[model samples]
Target: MEIIKTAIDGVVIIKPRIFTDSRGYFFESFSQREFDEKVRPIQFVQDNESKSSYGVMRGLHYQKMPYTQSKLVRCVRGRVLDVAVDIRRGSPTFGRHVAAELSEDNHLQLFIPRGFAHGFAVLSDEAVFQYKCDNFYEPQSEGGIQLIDDTLGIDWRIPTDHAILSEKDIKRTKLADTPLDFDYNEDLYKK
Candidate 1:
């Protein structure tokens, strides 16, 4: 696997090696040993999956402290425009975001560390998105920033008018208005 660093610290893009032929393709989706050596040492306890159609967008979401999660996300089928936004207070790249195109063809995975908000937009007819999280879901700890927060200037690739979002997601507050409990600690994410 190859690791690609983003502008923001602690966020990385992984390109896994795929072996293909007439028989089809194969790749190691996750190997704990390789992950521990490349990315930081993280114990993923839960795995989640979501299926969405074109123009569907979800997120700009994160969990509050104590329940904050680090995720290894990928598009197992079809394609998506995955995004991660730094929400760590006092970090040099606070409010900045990194985006990558993940698809079954590319076999790319994105590693989003704790203290970042994550979301994705389906770019294909249908997308099967999967992720491994270091923490379990906590409904009460859920928090989100508006998907189209003007300050962030994100181009979802899909036209804004064409995007479909849930009522809860559409009602999310702007980043500046949202209350966050994370403070950037260099030691915690230096890896």
Candidate 2:
């Protein structure tokens, strides 16, 4: 596997080695030892999967302190415009986002550390998205910023009329109005 660093520190794009033939293909999605060596030391406690249809947009969401999560995400079927945004106040790339096309074709995985908001828009007929998280879900600590906040204009790569969003997302606050507790250079990403 090869890991590519994004503009922001600790955020990474992972490309796994794929073996393809006239018949099919094979690849090890995850290996504890290899992962520990390649990425930061993390012990993923939960694996979650979601299937969504075209035009479905989810996120710009994260959990507050004491419940923040680090994730390794990938698409197993179809495609999506995956996104991660830094919310660490003192960080150089605060409010900046990294967007990538994730699909079954490319077999890429994204590593989004704690203090980042993650979201995705389905670009295919349907998609099965999987992610491993280091922390468990905490409903009370959940928070979200508006996906269409003008400060961070993300092109979901889908027509506006085709886009579908949840009620919670529609009611989310703009980045400016959302309260944050993280500094960009906080202890979270220390080596």
Candidate 3:
């Protein structure tokens, strides 16, 4: 596997080696040892999957400190535009975002650390998205920034009329109004 760093401090893109034959293709999606050597030592405790139709947009979401999560995400079927936004206070790239096309075709995975907000938009007719999180879900700790917040200026790669969003997501606070618990501590990335 090859890991590519993004402009943000802790976000990265991982490309796995694929072996192809007459029948099909094969790749090691995840290996504990390889992951630890390439990325930080994050003990993923929960795995989640979601299937969505085209135009579906989810996120700009993160959890508060003490329940913050680090994730390894990818699209296993169809395609999606995965996005991560830096929300750590005092960070150089705070509020900046990295958009990656994760799909079955490219087989790329994104590593999103705890201090960022993450979300994705389905680009294909349908998609199966999966992610591994180091922390368990905490309903009370959930928080998010509006996906369409003008300050962020994200290009979801889909037309506004075609985008489908949850009512809760449409009503999320803007980044400037959201309360973030993370500070730009260099040591935070050392882990």
Candidate 4:
């Protein structure tokens, strides 16, 4: 796998080396040793999967403090525009984001560290997305920034009228209005 660093610190895009033959294609999706050596050493405690159709936008969400999470995400069935936004209060890249296209053909994965907000928009007719989280989810700790916040300058690819969203996501506050607790100086990887 080749790890490509993004503009934001600690965020990365991983490309797997795939082998193809007349039979089919094969690749190592995850390897603990290589991940530990290449990226930061962390243990993902939970795995989650979701299926969505075109124009469905899921988030710009995060978990606050004690329950904050780092995620490794990929789209296994179709295509999606995956995004990660830096939300730490004092970081240089705060409010900035990195967007990458993940699909079955590319086999690319995006790693979003704890202090950022994560989300995705389905670009194909249907998409099956999976993610490994370093922490178990806590509903009470859930927080999010409105996906349509103009200040963030996100291009979700779906027209405003065509985009679909849940009531929860629709009610999320803008980045500036959302209260953030992450400190850039804090080592989020510390156990």
TM-score of each: 0.96, 0.96, 0.96, 0.99
Q: Could you tell me how far off, in angstroms, the CA of residue 74 lies in candidate 2 after the best superposition?
A: 0.5
> In candidate 4, residue 173 scores what lDDT?
95
Clash counts per candidate, in order, are 0, 2, 0, 0
Which pairs of residues clash in candidate 4, taking residues 3 or more apart in a chain or in different chains?
Answer: none
Q: Give the C-alpha lDDT of model 4.
A: 0.96
Q: Which lDDT tens digits does candidate 4 get at residues 1-191?
A: 99999999899999999999999999999998999999889899999999999999999999999899999999999999999999988899999999999999999999999999999999999999999999999999999999999999999999998899999999999998999999999987776
Candidate topping TM-score: 4
Please provide, for model 3 over 37-144, each residue's C-alpha lDDT reduced to its tens digit, 9 standing for 90 to 100: 988777899999999999999998898877889999999999999999999999989999999999999999999998899999999999999999999999999989
lDDT of candidate 2 over 1-191, digit per residue (tens):
99898888888999999998999999988888888898888888889999999999999889888788899999999999999999989888888999989999999999999989999999999999999998899899999999888799788888888989999998999999999987765676443
Candidate ordering by TM-score (highest first): 4, 3, 1, 2
Question: After aligning candidate 3 to the native by TM-score, how far in Å is the CA of 88 from where it should be?
Answer: 0.2
Number of the top lDDT candidate: 4
Alpha-carbon RMSD of each model: 1.9, 1.6, 1.5, 0.6
Question: In order, what lDDT does every prediction score?
Answer: 0.92, 0.91, 0.92, 0.96
Question: Over 4 Å off in model 1, which ranges?
Answer: 186-191
Question: Which model is ahead, 2 or 3, in terms of TM-score?
Answer: 3
Clashing residue pairs, backbone N/CA/C < 3 A, model 3: none
